[model samples]
Target: MLVEYNYVIICSDRDFSLDLKFRLKKYEDLAFVSFAKDKTEGLFVILKHRPDIVFINLSKNAPEYFKMVVELRQYFHNLPIIIGISNDKQYVFKAIKNHFFDYWLLPYSEWDISKSLLHAKAQIPEKTEPKTLCLKSYRDFQYLNTDDILYLKSDNNTTCFTMKNSSEIIAYKTLKVFEKQLPEQFKRIHQSYILNTDCVSGINYGKNLCTIAFNNSQVPFSKSYIKNIDELKKKLAQSAIFANK
Candidate 1:
């Protein structure tokens, strides 16, 4: 199945506005929902259409770009693209720090928009099944299907694999080694822990933590890994959609 990418363009300037819109529309997969002249109407369109991407102009005349970014971040945190357009390097740096997917200078060609749209598409995670992972250690090596593991925790020189059966597998493998062994659904949820997305039952955003409930065991989601938890939730949601089909 193919999904349509919807976009909302919020530009204060009339010049080059339609050109940009036209460029985005050229991709048959993407469709424009609304175009606004100011931040107020821009947000209205964004909320109404729930666009997959939003292109905003970073200019003094376009209200407070920083405030707009902050406000939109709250409402559309999961939206794949929040592109800031400006020629100022300082402004672009600030936007990047705030976690906008990409930024571009003004008077950009259609090719630039095409390049960015492609990049944003690449960022969205695709749904896939977990694979069996085998890791080697000094004494012995074990192989288990990825879905059978709850999480992996590293302590000094020993890395422990918490299995769905509540049994622990102690291996001398580093955290990085196991990370590479797992699939995309396996996420690093803590400095010392890598999570199995399938095992995570729910997340507590207020506590900045996640709860991975296995058959007889539970795993904790740490503060440092909250972002990865959120991302994994989105991937799991996307996977569920496919499974239902």
Candidate 2:
């Protein structure tokens, strides 16, 4: 399927100015523009437009960049998806840690952008059918659809996939692996757990966590992943508003 979503581009340097915007235009459904030098303007555009993606260049001094990420997190929690451009491994790691969907090298290429779009599409769950994901291992592999999923938890080396049928499948997969395949609705709330955003009942902001009431049980949100949870909350709020309109 062809997915069309609005996008906001933030770039401080001018090296690839016109080139990037021209290339982005090839995606007929994407509405994108280039920001001259104002970081705040770029952020405002994201908050105002609520685009499907935010593509930004990572600065050398990243603590400040993180502050912006955190701020956007507060308002856009499930902010479409963020793609950071940076060559430094440290900055790329930090962006992912902050919940950015993907990070690419400074010079943008069609292949890289295409890959990111595919990843984003995979993250957006479709309502037509329950999503099916396959679990692979040295001995045996299995496939489970979304309808069968109750929740997922990670423990050191292994991850547990709980099903609605009261069965659990323990597999060798990292939180990151499942994250890419799962829809945007599923968010990581703990270092060891991932919960569907729709499954969340309420958040205990004062305690720096939230609880997901799933299938007669409650799952705790880890403090480390609270930022991501809250961001998704914002996205949910915006969605509600749009529906009301």
Q: Give the TM-score of candidate 1.
A: 0.47
Off by over 4 Å in 1: 109-111, 125-245
Q: Model 1's lDDT to the true fold?
A: 0.75
Q: How well is each residue in 50-146 modelled by candidate 2, as lDDT tens digits?
A: 7777777775445665677788878864767878777666687688788989887756677988888878867754434337888889868798887
**Tens digits of per-residue lDDT for model 1 on 1-245?**
25667788888876656877866666887877878888778778888887778888776443365566677767865755788887665586678777788888766866777788799978765535457776766666678887888889998978898887888888876888878767766888778888887777666677655677766344566777777876877866775644331
RMSD of 1: 16.8
* Cα lDDT for residue 165, candidate 1: 83
- How displaced is residue 200 in candidate 1, in Å? 38
Which ranges in model 2 have alpha carbons more than 4 Å from their true place? 1-3, 33-36, 125-245
What's every prediction's RMSD, in angstroms? 16.8, 17.8
